[model samples]
Target: MVVDDHPVVRDGVALLLRGEPSLVVVGAAESGRTALERAPGLRPDLVLLDLRLPDMLAPEVVAGLRTGCPQAKVVVFTAHGDHHGVQAALDAGAHGALLKDAAATDLVAALRRVLRGERVSDPRMVPGTAGNQAALARSGLTRREYEVLRLAAQGRTNPEIAESTGLARNTVKTYLQSALHKLGARNRVEAIGKASEAGLL
Candidate 1:
């Protein structure tokens, strides 16, 4: 299974995986909602997912599938390598993290390892990871930022956050973007996720 919102990259990766003698591209979903709908039917042994999607956080994606298809091992394939990004996937029960820039051979090996019930991590993604707490505190966010972060962590859109918080939609977006930069996160998902690790949310 492959879950990514980018068509070109998703199709390209899928094409490569289809050539593996021991693997099959059982399903492809561009977003979490579709993944939840299709993953149960596909029953894939492993899932290759991106941590950022158009509709939901990747951790949510990982957690959701654990319920719908409890047996599948998930491998995160994403451009992000921030501490928050890596920890979020692991906390969501993912078996591994494969950076998007990793070689195809390495990606295959990670998949095999995860399917074998072992954890696989990209070394560069491991920034002296004593624990998520220390890493998250390094993000330096304020209480209000943490509030906005909690909603984003749950996969709410800027518009959704405005509705929930009574803030202007643009204000929510500004906070999310600012939070991302503050956390050294590449996206809203990673920022909010790191916040969760720090018990900020």
Candidate 2:
């Protein structure tokens, strides 16, 4: 199965996989909700999941897939390889991750490797560098913290965030402060910037 928001990318990937006699494209979806709704019915052995969907972030989609279709293996297919995104996806149970720029052959090989129960990632996105390692360490933001920070990044006030997340205003503030401290930011602006730089937002 292939899950990507862009029609071009979805069609392109379907075309690429169609050429492989050993592989078959069982389904495709344009949104995270649609993907989750289809997973149980399709029960695909492998899922090529785009990191940024129109309706859901990569981690949310990955977590949903893991819970809804535990038998399916998920590989994050993304354009941005920021540490936070990659780490979050992996932490959410993605078997591997590949950048959108990956060569067709590399993408096929990655799918094969993941099917064989091997974890894979593009070398460039690997957390081998000190900066990447540090970013990975900081990416341990709880789901609530991430939610608050993501909303805060959109210029939402604490009350707005609370209303959106269904949490109390004080709880929203607590999550925001925790996110800021974890991101080493003194203010929401700095936190948003850092989160963007780390690809958390």
Candidate 3:
């Protein structure tokens, strides 16, 4: 599946995906709404989602899609460099994410890795990977998801998140869900506090 607002980008990526024998260009759409609408029926093994769809944020899109397609893997493709956005994608339950400008081979490899049941978090462009769980508890969190939680704690809205990130709004929601579940919180506010208590934010 390819969920991007841009036809050229979507088609280009589709062309690339078609080349891999293990991969398939299952579906393509210009918006998250359309992606969600079609994805359930397509039963795609992987979703190559874009960060700039016209409806719903990418994180939210990822979350919704997961509920609709529990077995499908999601891979976020975007040019946004905000580490928090990358984390948010992971938090949203995305199997992987990559900068849109990343090498084509990188995207292919990421897809393969995610489909193989690997968790692929983008390394922070900075010095440390902070999203991993704090050592005090028997907990686990990818470094990227932690970044999403920290930013959500800082009070950024989904669109504000888009401005600050390379991720789409739905992808951010996915991160929120992952964080909330990990913290055993019922909502974002509680998730924030719990993550803070765990030194996750």
Candidate 4:
């Protein structure tokens, strides 16, 4: 099954897989709820799931697929490789996570590996491979702190970050302060620079 909210992406993936002799696109769904509801009946061998859906996040979708179709492997196919939701989905038992920007051959290879029971993550999304998770760990920054720092790096003010994240202004400030201290930076500007250098932003 292929699950993505965008019609073009959903159909495009399905079309691509149909061309591969080793694979079959059994079903396509535009949302997590629809995918879960249809998965049992479809009985697909694997699912290509988007990380963000209008109705649910990646982790929730992965959990539902696990329960509803335990026989099928779940692989997250997303554009937001750096989003914390990707990690959450992987932790929730997704077999693999591949970035949408990957070449078609790479995507097919990764999917084949997952179908053979191997866990795969895009190199850019992997910890030490891209210095993402390693940098995050070395800095001792929590997921929230990393998220806030990322937003700050994007030139968002504290209030804007709070509004975008649905967090209180003070909470955003505290997260930024913690992130700054962990990165050994004196202010947001320095923090952003250090994070960029470490590949954490």
- In the range 1-201, model 3's lDDT, one tens digit per residue, is 888898898888877777788887877878888888899999999998886577777889899999998889998877664645455667888887777777778788888889899966556322134444343244465554565766777788867765575677888778768867877899989888777676554
Residue 124 Cα positional deviation in candidate 1, in Å, after optimal superposition: 0.7
In model 1, the number of clashes is 0
**Where is model 4 poorest over a 10-residue stretch in terms of lDDT?**
124-133
The sequence of per-residue lDDT tens digits that candidate 4 reaches over residues 37-71 is 99999999999999889999989999998998999
Candidate 1: minimum summed lDDT over ten consecutive residues — where? 126-135
Model 1 gets an lDDT of 0.78
Q: What is candidate 1's CA lDDT for residue 43?
A: 93
Q: What lDDT score belongs to each candidate, Candidate 1 first?
A: 0.78, 0.83, 0.74, 0.86
Off by over 4 Å in 1: 131-201
The best candidate in terms of lDDT: 4
How would you encode candidate 2's per-residue C-alpha lDDT over 51-94 as one tens digit per residue?
87889988899999999999999999987654356777888899
The model with the greater lDDT, 1 or 2, is 2
Q: For candidate 2, report its TM-score.
A: 0.64
Off by over 4 Å in 3: 124-128, 131-201
Higher-scoring candidate on TM-score, 2 or 4:
4
